[model samples]
Target: MAIISLEYYSEVLGMNREVKVIYPEQNKVENFTGKEIPVLYLLHGMSGNENSWINRSGIDRLIRKTNLAIVMPSTDLGFYINTTYGMNYFDAIALELPKVIHNFFPNLSTKREKNFIAGLSMGGYGAFRLALGTNTFSYAASLSGVLTFNGMEEHFDDNPAYWGGLFGTMENFKGSENEILPLAARFEGERPKLYAWCGKQDLLYSGNEYVANELKKMNYDLTYETADGIHEWYYWTRKIETVFEWLPINYIKEERAF
Candidate 1:
């Protein structure tokens, strides 16, 4: 596997951004040749950059056997939304980033079924938002995601300016494009398969449960799981392996020496 740290200028964001890419080495795996590899657009939690998944979760080692390419982008605290403050982060992730990746690595497949997205905490919200809001990814996973804003006032109340910048006041948030629940309900056409995992003891558990129930009512292809865990790297690092297992991809067998 080849791990590359890519730095490039983004036309959508109007700035340079860094993305960590994990690509499979074709010759290292058995029976892999001349085929486009599936890609996973992995996202990080709040305050995490492109290096979070690799540095925190040991993702590089986990997917060493799989013939998959992973693209991890840094979005600061943008929540992967278009943002009320004029940053079109949603467009960046949903549209521009893919084009950028494909241009750089033409071997990565662009088909809906070959594309996937997943994230943790705020990024968990981002994964669903992107999947439901657009028809790009065929699958998505959320780990300890903040699926709803039901009782999150206390967390945002501490920093009104920060919250307002992202959503432009909580009053207009519910039915807006930034909201995930409404998107899930109102989405039309083909829906991406969804997977969500939240620890029972985590603060976001109730929200995850609520959203999972709502998806069930809507008959979304969703798989929700829970266990004893808290909102931290330890839980995410462990659960991400399960996320990989849940993805609908054929794992490449590692070549063994005789």
Candidate 2:
């Protein structure tokens, strides 16, 4: 397996961004198999960057074992959100990043069957948010994600600018006026297979459970787990392996080999 860091200007971001990509190496870089490879969009926690996953976790090896390609992008302190202060992080993640990567490496394709999102902490929040926000993903997993934004007004009401650059108001999250709920209400569209795991001792545990409970009652397919641990890299790294194994690969794009 080989890992490389790439930095380039983004038309969507209007600034430079960095990405860390891990693949089985270019035994043949430009061969263009004409076959689409599944992609895992990995995210990092707050104060972490694109390299955080590769540098700190065994993700590189895991990707090799899974025959999966990992795409990790830097979010800085943006909470993976486009704030009033800067770029549209969500758009970058949902659109531009995938486009750029596919353009640079033809191995990547735009099909939903080959796309997945997974992350830890802040990155976890991002992974789930983007997964729920669009139809581009076939699956998603978050290890301790910030799953709810219904209270962001009271929490950051004074700072309505918290994530303004990407979205003008919190109402945008609610999906619509009749739908007074946030992503929770609008999450069922072609619901991607969801999985989430969190440490029982983690601060975000409650919210994580809230997500699972709500989805459960609504009959949204999901897998939510809690274990004895904290919100540390060790816990997240360990869970990454579990998530890879748990991913719904039984629905692989390839047809039955009989």
Against the true structure, candidate 2 reaches a TM-score of 0.82
Clashes of 1: 0
Residue 178: error of model 1 in Å? 1.5
Best by lDDT: 1
TM-score of model 1 relative to the true fold? 0.95
Clashes of each: 0, 0
**Best prediction by TM-score:** 1
lDDT by residue (99-218, candidate 1, tens digit) is: 999999998999999999999999999999999999999999999998999888765678878888898777878788778878988998889999999999999999999999989999
How well does each candidate superpose onto the true structure, as a TM-score?
0.95, 0.82
lDDT of 2 by residue, 220-251 (tens): 67888898989898888778877877775431
**Candidate 2 error regions (>4 Å):** 26-34, 149-181, 249-258
